[model samples]
Target: MCRWLAYTGNPIHLEAVLFRAKHSLIDQSLHSRLGHTTTNGDGFGIGWYGHPTDIPFRYRCIQPAWSDRNLREAARAIRAPLFVAHVRAATGTPSQETNCHPFRYGRWLFAHNGLVRDYPAVRRDLMLAIAPELFPLIEGSTDSEVMFYLALTFGLERAPVAALERMVGFIEETGRKHGVGEPLNMTVCATDGEQIVAVRYSSEGQSRSLFHSTSFRHLRDLYPDDPRILAAGQNAFLVLSEPLVDLPGWWEAIPESTAVVARGGEIEQYPFTPELA
Candidate 1:
């Protein structure tokens, strides 16, 4: 349905991954190998964190990722310790600025790569579940935006993982109530500048393509001459919809129904299941 990536570690210009990497996010926007579609040209977004602001700065537009000069310039200029980017392939939603990826609130930035199956039948039910105070924050009609707010309503500011589970559980339940089985198919990443949480889950078991880069130390050993590797330090980590390059052993696939957390220069994984109870 879409493709996305998240980065955390030392502060680096977004251009490194979004443009300079082999088969970069910009290239993937036009030639995605693992997404539901080949080109995610409906819209695109970037959300990044810098000093002195708890909230992230966002840039979203309804332009093809490859044609955006502003995005290219911004990528080279903006540097951040943490960032999220998304290339959207509109399932049914309009290709509008508000419908782009990397939605933001407070210090949190989120991006998704899948859909809520048969969303129209379950949209009302899902929106009602969002917290009242946060409901007004919903600016887009995309299911992805709703999912972000649902997480917020379920305490994303505190218990991120648990809140996500609850959000998924509630969506699954609501979908079943409308006879729409298998309502969720998503590989999403959320971050608060402290830690990044990425989940790959689908009610039917098979999820979209999701991968993460190997450790910086390991990568340095593999490509010692690479300046990017040296600049990223030992903590450089990337969670992507697919590998940034064709290099094997550098990117690992996250198994179905799994959750990954990147923090403190480390990666941790755990079983992920919707909490219906």
Candidate 2:
């Protein structure tokens, strides 16, 4: 229903992926090949971490990404070592700026690319599950933001992957209670500035499209003359809802039911499944 990308690596301008990539997020906002909808014009947002702060700065609006001059200028001006950006497609939700993604809490930034099947029927149950302390911060009426709060309530800062598993389990359990057989569909990610934890999973085992870039070191080796790849350095990494470039060697599809943790210097995987007994 939406498209998102997260990057963690050497400091670089936001335009490198948001505007300059072969099939950038801006282009995807108007024409998405992998998203359920062609246009993700309902809204857009970006969150990035910069010098001297573990906290992130967020900018969001209910304007389509392709036509937003503000976004274009910001992308060209801001440089961050880690960032998360999203283009939204309204799916049974309002197009208010509050509903736009890349939601934030303290040092964490999160975004999602899919919906919770039949979310209206189960929204209350899900909302009630969020810790009472975090309930007031729920500014958006989208499942993505709910999921982010649930992760925080379930302990994201201390253990991100386990927190995600707990979040999914709670959603699945809550949905099933409301008779939704296929209740969850998502490819989501959250970052605490230093590390990124992303997951691709659904109750039915079939999830949304997600891929991670090959190591910049290998990419630099493959295209020695490419300035961008060389500039990103060996430690840079990217996880996207779809490949930015059409080339094969640069992107690898993440398999279904997987959680990826990118620690800048390395990428690690763990089998992901809901855990609620």
Local accuracy of candidate 1 as per-residue lDDT tens digits, 1-277: 7889999888999999999989899999999888889998998999988852478899999999999999999999999988899999999999999999898888888898889999999999899988898998899999999999999988888988888999899999998999987889999899998899999999999899999988889999999998888888899899999888887568999999999999889899998878862
- Estimate candidate 2's alpha-carbon lDDT, on a 0 to 1 scale: 0.90
Window of ten residues with lowest summed lDDT in model 1: 48-57
Candidate 2, 6-83: lDDT as tens digits? 998888899999999889999888878888898899999999998425689999999898989999999999998899
Global local distance difference test of model 1:
0.90
Each model's Cα RMSD: 1.2, 1.1
Q: What C-alpha lDDT values do all the predictions have?
A: 0.90, 0.90
| Error at 242, model 2, angstroms | 0.8
RMSD of 2: 1.1
Scored against the true structure, residue 55 in model 1 reaches a CA lDDT of 81
Clashes of each: 0, 0
